[model samples]
Target: MKFDVAVVGASPAGLSAAASSARTDARTVLIDRDLTSVPNANTIFEGMASAACLNVEPFSIHQVRGMRLISPSGHSLEIDAGGHFLDRKGFYAHYLNSAADYGAEIIESEVRSVSRSADGMELFLSTGDVIDARIVIDAAGVDSQLASSLGIKTMRHPDDVAWAIEVDVRHPGIGEEDRFEYWVGSIAPGWKATFSPAGEDMATLGVFVRRHGRDVQRFLETFLKKFISRRAGSHPGLERMRILGTRRGGDPIAVLPGRIVDDGIMVTGGAAAQSGLAYSMRAGEICGDVAGRAALERDPSRERLSEYSRRWWRELGFEYILGRASLERLRSMSDDEIDRLFISLSGRNLLVPGGLWRKSANAAFQLTKAMPSMLPRFLLNLLRF
Candidate 1:
C-alpha cells in the first residue's frame, strides 16, 4: 500500500487525521490492529458536539442532564451543564465510516516494524504486506507501539498512571434519572466511584485508582458492593441487578508530552497524554489539520510539523497542567479530606476539577476557599513534578 499519510490506530485522533489528510486530496490510509474492538472514550456530550462540528454524527446519543457528586457519607451535589452519554459501539463505527467516506482507505492490520528513509516511512505489517507513506500519525492509546518504535518516551510517570475498571449494568433505577451519581470513599480512596447512565435501564459503574500496589478487581468490587448497598435502599432495584459487561484499561492522567512532533511523525490523543474526550478530539483535529497541510507541502519534517505541537499546547496546556495537578492532589488527599472537598463543593455548581475546572472562575475560587489545605498539594505537584 502507498499513501501520502498513514495513520496508526483507529481511535479519534487517527480517524480524524485520515479524514483531514484525505480532505486535502492526499492519499491517506488508516491502519488498526482490529476494527471491532476500537477503544471508546465513552463520548462526552461536548465530544459529540465536536463530532458535529467535524460533520460526523454520534450514531445514537443519550443526553445527560448533569453529574451528581456524592461524599463518602452520601451528601450529594449536582451540576447543571452535564455531559452526553453515547452508544460506544455506534460512535466508534460512525467515526470509522466517516473517515472512509472522506476517501481514506481503512485497513485492518498490525504494524510489525517501522523504518524511515530519505524518501518516506515504511511499515512492515503482520499480514505480510508493506505500507509506504510520506508522513505517519501515531494515535495509538497509552500502549503505543509506533511511538515507542520512534523512540518517544512514555508521557506519564508511575504516579500519573491509574487503573480503571468499568462495568455495564441493567439496573432498573440507574438511567431513570437525568443526573449521574459519583461517590467518594475508601474503596476508590481519592477517586470517586461513578454511575453514568446510558439509557432508561442501563448505566456504567466505574472507578480509576492509583496503579501502585493494589488489586484492580478487588478494589472495583469493594466499591461496587458498598455503593450499590447504599443506593439500593433508595432505588429498590439493586437487589437483582447483574453485570452486563466489563472493561479494564489504563488511564494516563498527566500533562501533555513536551513534544508530540518528530521527524516524519506526529502523535496525538491518549498517546500524547491528552486524556479527556474533548481534549483528545481537539488535539486530534488540530494535529490532523496541520499534518494534512504539511503533507500537502510534502514536508513532514519535525520543524514543519512543530506547529501542531505548539498550537495544542498554546490552547490546552493550562488545562492539562491544572488537570495533572488536580489528579495528583486527589491521590494525595486522605479519605476524610476527599469527603470534605466534596462537601464544600456540593450544590455550588459542581465544577469538578479535572475536565470541568476550566469553567466558571467563581466556582474555582469558591473551591479554593473551601479546601485551602489541598492547595499545597496541588502547588507542590505542579512545581515539583
Candidate 2:
C-alpha cells in the first residue's frame, strides 16, 4: 500500500506524526510491533515535577506549576519548574486517540528496512507489506535501529542513557499532593531514587543512572525497602497495597540529537533522540506536528525534512536543550557538590543564569547559603574559571 508518510513506531512520536500528517490530508500509516498498544508503550511514570512538562505548557497542561527542590544534603530551596506531571495513561491515550481520530491508520507490524525510491522511500515490513511513502518518519525511541541505518546517530552519549528500574508500589506516605521527592546522595552514583504518585491509591518507586554503572535495580530495590520501611511502617494503607507490576530502562536523558532526518526520511520523538524522560512526559505533540507538516508538503528532500528539526527547536527544543545541558553539567559534579547546589534552585526560587552580572545579587545570596564554610574556596573556583 502507498502512504503520504509511513511512521515506523506508534508511540507518542509516531502517533503524533501520523496525526500531524493526516491533518494535512496526507495518507499517513502508523505501524508498530505490538498489536495491543500499537507501539507497545509501557512504563510507570511516577513523581512528575512541574518542570518536566514545560513544552506543552498553556496547552494541555493548562494549570500546572513547579515547587521547591529538596536536596539530599537536607536543604530545600524554592524555585519554579514550570511544567506538569502527566496523567500518563491519559496523556498517551489522548495523543494516540487523536492520531486515529484524524483519519490516520495505525497498524501493528515491524519494518525491516527502507529501500530507495525514485519519488521518496519504500518501507518493507516483516508482514510482506510494502508501504510506499514519500517520506518515512522514524519516531522510534532508544534503540532506533532503523534511524542508525540512515546514518543518524541513534546511540545517546554514554552519560545520556539512564538505566532504570521501578516498582509500581503503593505507599501511604506519598499522597497526591506530596508525590515528588528526589533522593540524591552518595548511596547511589550518577543516579537517584524517585518517589512519585502514579494516581489515586498508587505510587511508583524507581532509580536511574547516567551511563554504564553498577546495578541500579539493586540500589533502587534497597532504597525502596528503606523508604517504605521508614515511612509506611505505621500507615495501614501501605500494607493493603499490592505491587501491580515493575518497569525498567529505555530512558535517554541527553541533548536532543541533530539531523533527525536525512535524504527522504524524518525522525522525531525518541528515535530522533529527543530526551526520553522529557519527551515521554511531554513534547510528543509538537514533534508529531512538525513531522506531519513536512510529510504533507511532500518535500521528502533533506532540506524539507530539516524543517521538522527547526519546528521542534522553536517549540520544545530550547527547553530540552537547557534542561538537558543543565542536568548533564550537574552530573559531572561530585555528589556533595550537587546536593549543595540543588539547595539553591529549589521551590519557586526562580533560578536563572544571567552570568555574574544580572544574577549578581542572587548569586551572592546563593553563595552564602550554598557555601557557608567553603566561601573562599568556592569563590576561588568561580574566579579561576
Candidate 3:
C-alpha cells in the first residue's frame, strides 16, 4: 500500500498525527504492533483527551482537582489542576476510530524495517507487506527499536528513565474528590510513588525508580504494606484492600529530544522523549500538520520538517525542561534534604511553571526559616539556565 504519509505507532501521538494528516487531505496510514496496549496511556488519560481532541465524558470515571505531594515527614503540598481518571482502553479505540473517520488507514502490524531511498521511505511490516510513504512519522514510543535506525536519540541519562509498576486497589476509603497523591523521599528514592484514584473504591498505586535493574514489584509491595498501614489508622478501609489488576513498564522521563526530524522523517510523542501526554499530543499535532503538508508538497527534507520541533518548543518546551530540572534536583537530594524541602515549600499554592516564579520566591524565604543551607540549591533550580 502507498500513502502520502505513514505514521508508525498508533499511540495518542501517532493517532493524532494520522488524523491531522488525513484531515489535511494527505493519504495517511498508521501501523502499530498493538494499538490497544499502550502502557503509558493511563498515565495522562485526561490531559490527552483534549490534546488529541477526544471527549472524555464517555470513558472517564473520576475527576481530579489537583495533586498532593507528601514528604517523608508527612508534610504535604497541594497544587490545583483539573484532570480526570479515564478508561484507557476505550480512549485508544476512540482515537483510532477518530483517525479512521478522518480517512487514515489503520493497520495492525509491527514495522520490521524502515528503509529510505531516493524516492521516499519504505516500511517492511511483519506480515510480509511493504508500505510506502513520501514521509514517515516515528511515534513508536520510548522503547522504540526503530528510533536509533532513524537517527533519533531517546533519553540520555539513567536518571531520566524510570521503570514503574501499578496495581488497582479496592478500598472503601477511596474518595470521589479526585486527588492524586505523591509520596517522595521515603517510598522510592530518586523517584516517587503515586496514588491516583480511578473511581469509587478503586485506585491505582504505583512506584517509579530511577535505576533499571531494581525490582518494581518488591518496592510496590513494601510500599503498599508500610504506607497503607501507616495511613490505615486514619482510613480503616485500607487494611481490607486487595489488588485487582497490575501493570508495569519502563517509562522514559526526559527532556524532549534535541532533534525530532530528519530527511523524509519526523519523530513525535514518546519516541521523541516528549513523554508527557499533553506534550506528546501537541507535539504530534505539530509534526503531523508539518509532515502532512510537506508530503503533499513532495518535500520531506529535514529543513522543511524542522518547523515541527520549533513550534513544539514555542508551545510547551519550557514546561518539559523545567519539569525535568525539578525532578533531577529532587533525585539528587537526600531524604532528609527532601523532607526539609517539602516542609519549607508546604502550604503554598504550587502550580508548576505558571506560579513557579512566585513559588520559588516563597520557597527561598521559607527555606531560610527551615533549612537555610539548602536555599542555594532551591534558588539554583528557579534561576538556572
Best by lDDT: 3
Better of 2 and 3 by lDDT: 3
* lDDT of model 2 at position 38: 26
Model 2 residue 178 lDDT?
Answer: 36
User: All candidates' TM-scores?
Assistant: 0.90, 0.77, 0.88
The local distance difference test score of each candidate is: 0.74, 0.61, 0.76
Model 2 agreement with the true structure over 13-33: per-residue lDDT tens digits: 666667867887778788888
- Worst lDDT run of 10 residues, candidate 3, spans 348-357
Against the hidden true structure, what lDDT does model 1 obtain? 0.74
- Candidate that would win on TM-score: 1
Q: Any runs in candidate 2 off by more than 4 Å, and if so which? A: 38-68, 78-87, 154-159, 187-190, 213-215, 229-241, 276-297, 342-348, 351-385
Clashing pairs in 1: 45-84
lDDT of 1 by residue, 292-317 (tens): 78888999889998999888877777
Candidate 1 Cα errors over 4 Å, as ranges:
47-61, 213-215, 350-360
